[model samples]
Target chain A: MSEKNKSDMLRAPFKLEYDYERSTGPIIGKFFEGLSNQQILGTKNGDNVYVPAAEFDPITYEHLSEFVELPETGTVKSFTWIDQPRKHHLINKPFAFALIQIDGATSSILHMITNCNESDIEVGSRVKVSWSEEKTETIKDISHFELINE
Target chain B: MSEEKKDHFISPISLDYNYTAGAATTRFLKKVSEGKIVGQKCPKCTAVYVPPRGSCPRCGVATEEEVELVDKGSVESFTIVHIPIPGNPIVPPYVCAMIRLEGANISFLHLIQEIDLKDIRIGMRVEAVWKDKSEWDTTLENIKWFKPSGGDDIDPSEYRFKGPE
Candidate 1:
């Protein structure tokens, strides 16, 4: 064995692999079931029904059961610019994901915006779902929220 | 908040992984219990891998040939572990290291025993000290630890040990 051989061995590498599972709770479960039925549902907290049901009532802290249908059209209450997206997000490129308060709903649902460039997105923009001809009980089934014309 | 029955919160954090390994490693552990060191050779690149890998990471092909590596090697890098990791058998305040076996292209981690922690050094020549045959299992721990090879302390800069370049 040569001394040179000892120096080179110090930088050897090792590789490992691992598998993981995630748990989805009751709220997300009901949302998925609703998507499977091709209907979006929300829960009424008090006087106003939220587009996406609250897991826990904001004021009362009790479980909500009242479900209601909201119009697909909604006004973007707020949004964040995603110049780079994560692997599991609906869109992989630059997009505006927003919280939209749909008609007949008091609270907003979190979703992504697509089918247009980032420059066109704004806080008051109207967006609608580009529903799949075939739907599943998942948010991804809606493809992405598309900007709607006034 | 009540004085005797106040609100309390509890949080749970844990790590569990479904550890998977390549076929080559399965064979290596099986052989380790028998007090043998095994490696696989990449025919094209000529790099030997201990705890053999299914494919050559550098050449991008399966390493088909199995080679028996020498039990003797030298410490490439080492650390004095003062903190104990849960599930590790050894108590803390021990020395652990990557030992590059002679004639093999990679290093394997194991405990270093029978030496003062302060005396252990990089490039120290050591050889496998195996467990009694009756206690051998499919684990690297079958070899108790690498004991110092009775040779004189060679200069760290010129300690010639076998391994890949």
Candidate 2:
């Protein structure tokens, strides 16, 4: 019956974490394998090249097999800037989640752009892949992107 | 590139969150820091909830009256944990119990200490073994664990969930 109702509440930062073994199957696995060697790959749908190889054609719904290697450089088509990142985010500093279209590829892939200010980036900003020092054969192999100073 | 193609990937996911203990439970924790245990008494069914969460589940009524309880209880049920918990100082094969405190209708979970794993049985008497008074804070964790109190074993059925008969 103290005046100060000071008791510890369960309001604290908590981290729920787990590691799961996931099967990449065939098509997606090949793309990850290419990332391990610092290569970017896409699947061809007629005249268009789709980055992050699609397993089946969107229009025809047929299995597409042709793989095309593309450049790591890309242009940010759409993005949302994170002024303040949370603890779970891979990049602790300010960054942007971007939909980037790789040069010569008709489709875009989702990735992060870091090490820049808000004024340094805009829609259609030229960026290049910033590879992680360690390779895990996953999308994280391409850790993030940086604005190309061209 | 080398020959092998990858088949499997280990995906590690980490989620951050905030957990808040609402009103009634907050009052209970404050009592615990002062070296007392308390619960909220339901207005409708009159069932006492330890570490009270404000509302009664059976009657769906607010439990406003606070009922203070002694730091003693009986083990309604218990499990001896064999697997080691990450970042826990306790060794394997410790006893975790569902303790039904005296004056409370419901049971709450806490660790049991100062006894062998085999000797632990249902209906056994136990008392809260709290941390030093200086270390006490507004948390259920004020009670470090529970220990045997050398009292006669109460009937297990006494602490069983009370429902409409």
Candidate 3:
């Protein structure tokens, strides 16, 4: 084929973009605000407490309004070791994405666990939230969970 | 309860796509780049389709015959866009029309220009205005826009397809 034909058959670059601005409503909005101040907050639905503050009762389906301040330290319920990290991952090095059940909260919150090896961590391992030096009103405000000395 | 303003956040998203134009579309686009209009004719219904799909939508049979279509055709329907939108190829107050090419069974949507927006009417004759030969490519963008072909308007009844009652 000719050079002109080759050029004609070349694929064109196309990009799709969407810029969206939205409100987080009353429930999740307060959760992000607490993260900005380096505090962990949850919502209590009767006997059960949700760490990643749910907007509604998981069981009753009623709107949840009761807020509970949760301790930063928790135990790792389950974790998976990432031997190799991808570019989009929060941490560049190997880390574990774990479900940590914070103190006084019944439901566990999923987060990254770092500053330890694969062999050093397991289920029921003690961990604490590590606050970022620069806090933003986002989940990234808590850098990652670290292994507790105890 | 004290009335407090709800907090809002902005999130920006971007995605890229690499599409492969298959066999039938590749043939149609190649002819378009060569300053020609080609359509695939359905064997069962004799319907000719521009930007030819490999198979007939109604008959569900393969369209194998290539039919050359005229650049001039009639505008079956049109609407003048009055509201401005982001990333629009053309400004507001322009006309977008569904044009049925002569000798083709289907009508396709394209921008109509070089005529008064209000003057654009049903069955108005129009023709494709192609870009420079050097700028031509295997894409519909090669045809810059459809403009009034300067002829008497055809009767809408003649172009309208009568479906089974």
Q: For model 3, which pairs clash? A: none
TM-score of each predicted structure versus truth: 0.47, 0.70, 0.78
Candidate 2, B1-165: lDDT as tens digits: 235767888887778777676667777777887998888888877888997988999899888998998899899999999998666898988999999999789899999999988889999999999899999987888899999998799897787667534
| Interface RMSD per candidate (angstroms) | 11.9, 2.1, 2.7
Q: For each model in turn, which proportion of the native inter-chain contacts is also found?
A: 0.00, 0.91, 0.69
A46, model 2: CA deviation in Å? 9.2
What are the per-model DockQ values? Answer: 0.03, 0.57, 0.49
What lDDT score goes with residue A125 in model 3?
A: 95
What TM-score does prediction 2 earn?
A: 0.70
lDDT-based ranking, best first?
A: 2, 3, 1
Q: What's the residue-level lDDT of B97 in candidate 2?
A: 95
Top-DockQ structure, candidate number: 2
For model 3 the local lDDT of residue A44 reads 97
Off by over 4 Å in 1: A1-150, B1-12, B86-89, B152-165
Off by over 4 Å in 2: A1-33, A41-68, A75-77, A81-95, A103-107, A114-127, A133-138, A146-150, B1-20, B119-121, B149-153, B160-165
Could you list the CA RMSD of all candidates, in the order they appear? Answer: 13.8, 4.9, 4.5
Which structure is stronger by lDDT: 1 or 3?
3
Docking class of 2: medium
lDDT of model 1, residue B134 = 99
